[model samples]
Target: MITAPGGRTLDLANLRCVFTLQGWTTSQWGSAVFKIYNLSDDTANAIQAGEFSSIQLIAGYQNNSGILFDGKIRYSSRSLENKTDQVVTIQAVDSHDAKVYATINQTLGKGYDAARVDAALMQTFEPYGVTRGRTAKMPGTKYPRSKAMFGRSTVYQDLLAKQCRFLWQFINGQYVSIFEDASLDDVIVLNGRTGLLGVPTQTIGGGAVIRCLINPTIQWRSLVQVELQSATTGYFIVNSINCQGDTMGDDWYMDLNCTAHNNLVDKPHKDSSKN
Candidate 1:
């Protein structure tokens, strides 16, 4: 079961839910989508429409020892199957996106590396509870540049990370440390012990795709090792994730779509004049 955050203070016994989450590091992959389903409560009304709220979801499989997806809920929806069954659907951008947009105005000085730029962005985000590990490689000597803040933090962070060979995202409302390439090492070892659900199959992303039981331990950009005794046994970076489960019934799993360490997407080039 996954924990849902809201004003109502929900418990496992009182909720029913399912969700598919998509997270990304490259521009082509786009924003995170957390499509959530929930039964309408007789009293609480958790899925009301308004930009005044955010949700933190901690998802995992039946044992509750893993992290399927860890992030925020920024958008939502609802529908009816007759009057007795209702599913509240929610669409959320990654917390990193929300943080960048919510961060009103700030300016990074004329000279700073990508790592330093991330530090400045974190200043605006520290209060929101960020999650991340150590620095990956902040390669490229594009150490000094002039960037003035005209709008959202997303605009600025994207430009800086790309030029310096890095990318960032927010996990469960906190920032996961930016990395040049996250799949090079294995952070989570996946096999029969950790719910290895399939062998490598050809998927849309060109790299091999694997799905496993859901848990809250793995976050976007974290490394995972698939130790199956085949061509699939190797390290990979988490490209995307989908956390699906229902608390009202006995069904749940987390799907991880990853890119090999050597295949992480490149950040797009930004026109310096545009910034």
Candidate 2:
């Protein structure tokens, strides 16, 4: 069992981090080496699977004490010689050392909404058959990239557009604020939905708030002549919406059911807009 460190308020429940064999891939007698590096720091410490690693983060408070990691076996090959490493990482805490009380899980505050977002991302990308590759953009990059696309389907663009949409809906009412009439880049207040307005109250040059439609419930197929941002084109489904904004940064996150569409359709007038 992992223990919380001193001066820390939270700890990673190692037991809770369950792992499963996702799948197996064989590359016709090719070698594959995989490693996990800390994206939060400059040091590219390789972490071993099923162990803890230290990851210093910015923006949120973190424990100076080390961290824990749980990873799967990495497979590597160089033509018939295949090898796998036990998951590994830079040690953050000692099991026998004094437990520090630091906020170990930076995203714990995001709660279930964060989980929902992760699920959406995984569902969208995993099916595309993308694989991780060594980074030329930055030396010693550990994460995977889309090394190949079966049909050149532009999956990355679609994923980004969908993510932006999700962010837009999530920031509504929960992060409330109005943008200026002229400025394209203004920090708007985000308040999770309160059901007052189903759309963005502000926009530039009388255009569609494409980001505003990212919520799970906003049916994208119903739009008609609504000018959209270049990076966005899709539909959304609202599986469930929970609104409970009573405190600062407190949100009422909704469970969503989303879909994407490539064609325009006739816009149905709402009951309130009746003359």
Candidate 3:
């Protein structure tokens, strides 16, 4: 679905769309690419003219459908295919990407703790349209006087995550941080009945790579229960997901890279103020 100018929603049957949504558990920004075909001239012009603001990709069966990608359009272009069909391709990044390179130059006073610093940062990001989502408990580290924060916001976020021994990323439009070994409560069960495509394969690092029919319930940092072969049956933490789908093609599926839950080892904690 696309939100064009004037708040109009576009989802025509003649419009064919293929998208790739990539997610990661690190501080890197998640991104999406959408190729829409057979759009009307007006719609194509609107998109190419930078009149479209946001796009959403939803998948799964009727009652189980959910958002697969939601982001602001960063670029759009129109091209002719076979000299007959007009296609528009859009590239987008999650909300956090908009502010990843934003500069932050603030000074904290003495006795400011981790919680207070986090709150101040969130307040700064609010004006940029990023809201705080679930975040792990920050370490109990207090800053001394003249704690200067400078440079890109993402760099600070990465430093903070490393200091706390956690991972942080943006999903949809919200910022989230979580411990490496912790998992979301909602566990998606994957099996023959639930659209598991083939036997999962193990990576050299003991992680698993799997493919399945598009399921929106599967997301980054979430847990999935593999119920196929005995050797591969266990809970896994999703590290990354690549969702590929085409309305007019047989390419609707999700490829996930996951680590076995039991194989995850928490990193040793470090002093937050050392950096």
The top-ranked prediction according to TM-score is 3
- Name the better of 2 and 3 by lDDT: 3
Please tell me which model should have the higher TM-score, number 2 or number 3.
3
Residue 14, model 2: Cα distance from true site in angstroms:
16
lDDT of 1 at 260: 63
Question: Model 3: runs farther than 4 Å from truth?
Answer: 4-9, 12-14, 144-146, 229-232, 263-275
TM-scores of all candidate predictions against the true structure: 0.68, 0.18, 0.87
Candidate 3 shows a clash count of 0
- Candidates sorted by TM-score, descending order? 3, 1, 2
Lowest summed lDDT across 10 adjacent residues in model 3 is found at 266-275
Runs in model 1 deviating more than 4 A are 1-8, 12-14, 27-46, 49-52, 61-78, 96-116, 125-147, 183-186, 204-206, 229-232, 248-251, 261-275
List model 3 lDDT by residue over 109-139, tens digit each. Answer: 8988766666666666676668788888787
lDDT of 2 by residue, 42-109 (tens): 11221223222222211111321221111212321112122532222222211111111111111212
Instruction: Write one digit per residue (lDDT tens) for candidate 1, span 1-275.
Output: 22344444443344655555565545322233433344436422544535324444555545655433444555556677456666666555545445644463656566655556666765665555554434444543454666555566566667766776665555445444444553323367788777778675556756556677766677565567777765345666666666566655555655667766444224222212100
**What TM-score does model 3 achieve against the real structure?**
0.87
lDDT of each: 0.54, 0.22, 0.77
* Candidates sorted on lDDT, descending: 3, 1, 2
Error of 3 at 272 (Å): 19
- Give residue 12's lDDT in candidate 3 (0 to 100): 50
